[model samples]
Target: MKGRVIVLDHIAGREAAALLVDGKLTDLLVDDDSAPRPGAIFRAVCDRPIKGMGGMMLRLPDGETAFLRQGKGLALGQSMLVQVTGYADDGKAVPVTDRVLFKSRYAIVTPGKPGINISRAIRDDDVRDRLLACAHEAGVAEGFGLIIRSSAAEAADEDIIEDIAAMDALATAIMADADGAPEALTEGDGPHVLAWRDWVEPAKVVTDAGGFEDMDVLGQMVSLGQPRVGLDGPAFMYVEPTRALVAVDVNTGGDTSPASTLKANLAACRALPRALRLRGLGGQVVIDMAPMSKAHRREIEGALRSAFKTDTVDTALVGWTPLGHYELQRKRERLPLPAEVMEALA
Candidate 1:
């Protein structure tokens, strides 16, 4: 409870992983079998261009259509490789990208981008040099780029080199299959794999059966179903999701001091990222912060920025709206918690 713990288990027959820090559920990954997962590579055929949207539709071998924005100059019936970027909304085509990447725990292989780069977080000169050496030793193919992830800083030299080699080989194999008909080249990493890949920090790993129950992960997950998230300063926030956007309402529970509004707003900013992450909520987010003076807007903005800086999801803080609401645009990287998952936990 005082440190980090990773719980790998099955929920409702789906593979799942949960990260707990200081006894609190910090992050979660659950498999969604219904849709093509993000990071899945496919050789798709160009269908038709939607000039009005500045994008094109693609036809996959499974008879599903994907939307690729900024896909210009793709002639009809032409075969090209694409990667699923995120899940689609109801009745919408899955979003795909032309820029496909092969990612692993220690290295990421970029096909078109040719260069060897180190993570900026690894500031030690010796570490950076050693990581660069590892990348060079792995031997990146021509027209491909290698990125040494920050996790490689503490990893063994051989392990880093091996990871790089594996990713490079995978990218080569996938690219070579682009000449064929539209079909899925490779599926994305599942929950357990993603947990190991992304949650690289020091933590106790639990893989035994009933580990979720033993670690109280199921109890914590139950709370995620509710919209209420308690914050510091005795504040609270309701993170409700609707069809259009996620609406967050912050309130100062029992604090009536003159600084209550600002305190509650800042607390909401700090707790928001985790709440959204656990809920698997994304897309448009409108935060109706507790009533505060306009002078404190910059401070709230700074708090929001600091809060989401470490979050893994792609989020854009769009600043305050005219109606005193703060807006955020988040990428739908994770699917919403399905009903079956909650039932299984229960």
Candidate 2:
């Protein structure tokens, strides 16, 4: 399946969610609670770039070392555990990465993502409630928030109940099993992945066309109402990340517009910023707009800027050198999406 990647951040506590599909990353949704909390570890008011003081480690509310460095980006009303992705020659904060050690401080919850975070300060009632908590979407009751994942959307309450039961038992059984492991817990596809897959896949794969059908047989489309669907295809892929480097190669193909190579190529140019956004490509992005005309150059430049509006992270076209290449500087956030996202339309 051409799976997408999403990193769920700041849920319940300073925790990050690893949303991977078939392994390629398609999205990164960092969960930051939009609510106000008392004595929150990372207060939202500290809206400044990390000072990267000798790559200091932050002590989390749960007492984990949230790492941080100098020059990390900070959002308004957001908190984080950070460490410098870069360090000075003397081992101080480097203006570079500003890597965050911990996850987002915004441990807020909502619908659309299914999850259950048992507090470290587990209460007997909380444990019992988790143990006896009806996974049934309809009957779920407790002080703790219950995320009903997308996979469970059409699932019978009984099935979810059993899932909850199994999950609780597994958590219970694993406590003894986690004898020496420092990193707490184990996992499977949490509800967020299931919901997202359910939501985005169908609309992307509406193939009523010939034999290349989306035949899960059970591969049914949402007949009534709900969210969208995502397709499971080979076009998607995930790649190992390395220090800031990116290359985009436009392969002439079915959509390459033979009518006018310039226009087709222009589409590709217009696509750079978006392609970058969807895939979260960072570090210097070197773009080759497939060699075109002088006037075409101006048009391509304009298109590149227009597409850049979609970027959540800051970026700039540092102008092309005499080599006819453009430069794009992207932020280094969590795991980036794979470069393969553009090939899906292929």
Candidate 3:
């Protein structure tokens, strides 16, 4: 599978990153430094306890505050480890936990937690059993837990062991070095890096002059320009994301034939998930698909489900509404992609 093309352009003075698969926009990359994300580990100092809320306020080294449950007997100014569980928007405290986890491409490693767990996504009993046996033979140090990722189902035993061992060492290092005021011991995956890992290896990477060094091509097929990319033929889509929901409209453009329209509609379904990821479109999302018969709607839905499986964030199809509009619910943690991008631009 060919990896999607990543375009870094300056949109309204701020850097804009876009992902394109098969010449169609998949997602828009955005970043926010203020919010703590899942899988990020931090060493924080416990401030005062909130008996009413059953938690304690933690001041991070970076000056951000997070709230942790179970404050009883916890003295003030005590240093602790915390990981972001979820965002508590609406002026509420950010939820955090002491249970820290580290994830690689193939496994999730935990410190002070023993035993091995397998991802439920791996449904093959035989494969799961084999992986379990491999984990056992890994001989990982005590006080650590390893959860095999579904991506490891096709991996060799040695590779799995190596990944686990590396993760174990990383976990140990983090604990040993995590000290002092609240600070991050580890950073979450970058948007582009995570996208590449989950999707395809990039066939070509393009950027403007004096762009990010890491994304420039000397060894890779990198191009320098104004960072503009266009889709071939007549397939196109207009994506508008609101505070509460995202609306995507698919168009076949000049294609008028029945077969061509169906083809365009199917392509749009394939592109919709990618657009969602690129834009980080979470919460309720409605795709206004091209008008088609009921029989074709099933095909479009199936295509959408297949494409959605590749999304890094959790999403579900709520089925078609009475108005014949396809409804979807995606998990909301941080602000949507557009909001973050606009903030940066501002």
Which 10 consecutive positions of candidate 3 have the poorest summed lDDT?
219-228
lDDT, candidate 3, 1-346, per-residue tens? 1456676654434444556566545555445555776567789888878888788998876567888897877778888778776555546666788888877767778778887889998899999999998888775667888888887888888988887877778888887865687788876655554544454343466666433334421211221111211123686777777655778777778888877657777887776665555444567888777777888887888888898887767888899988887889877544543443344333
Alpha-carbon lDDT, every model: 0.93, 0.38, 0.68
Write candidate 2's Cα lDDT for 49-158 as tens digits: 44445333333333333334432344433443222231122132222222211111112222223455433433456443543344433332233234434344334456
lDDT of 1 by residue, 290-342 (tens): 99899999999999999999999999999889999999999999988989997
What lDDT is obtained when candidate 2 is compared to the true structure?
0.38
Q: How many clashes does the backbone of model 1 have?
A: 0
C-alpha positional error of residue 346 in candidate 2 after TM-score superposition, expressed in Å: 18
The lowest-lDDT stretch of 10 consecutive residues in candidate 2 is: 217-226
Cα distance off (Å), candidate 3, residue 285: 1.6
Task: For model 2, state the Cα shift of residue 254 in Å.
Answer: 6.9
Q: Is candidate 1 or candidate 2 better by TM-score?
A: 1
